[model samples]
Target: MTNPLKTQVLIKIDTITYKGHSVIRINIPPQKEISFVGEKAFIREDSSTVEAKGPKLLAVSQLFQK
Candidate 1:
C-alpha cells in the first residue's frame, strides 16, 4: 500500500537562549506536486524567497506534465 500524501510543509525553527553554537536546519522532502504563487514558483533559501528562473523554471513547469 502507498503512504497517504502530505502536501503540508514541516519546518523546524529553534529558539536560541544560551550563547553557544547555534544551528538552523530545514527538512523539505521531495515534492509530490508543485505549487505556484501568482503563476510563478518561488524557492525558499534560508530566510529569503526568490523566484525560480531559467532551468529551475523549466523543471517546475515539467512537474505539471507529470
Candidate 2:
C-alpha cells in the first residue's frame, strides 16, 4: 500500500520524522475571495514560518517551493 499524498513516516529508535515529496494542486477560481486565519496562513521560508499577507501570500501559494 502507498499513501496517495506521497508522504512518508519514519520511526527511529528515539525519534519520528515525516517527509512529503509531491505536488498538490488546488483549483481556485479567478477573483474568488479567500480568507485565511492568522494561524492557518503561514509560509515556511527556509527555517522560519512567515505570516502570509500581501506579497507573502503570493509567495506562499507557490507550494513546495519555499
TM-score of 2: 0.32
Instruction: Output the worst ten-in-a-row residue range by lDDT, candidate 2.
Output: 4-13
**Which parts of model 2 are misplaced by more than 4 Å?**
1-35, 38-40, 62-66
In terms of TM-score, the best-performing candidate is 1
Q: What are the lDDT figures for the candidates, one per model?
A: 0.61, 0.45
lDDT of 1 by residue, 2-66 (tens): 23222333333444545686655554556666656557778766899888988887887787788
lDDT of 2 at 59: 56
Q: What is model 1's C-alpha RMSD? A: 6.7
RMSD list, candidates in order = 6.7, 12.3
lDDT of 2: 0.45
Could you give candidate 2's per-residue lDDT for residues 1-66 as a string of tens digits?
A: 123212222221132343754444433323223234534565458999667777777655654344
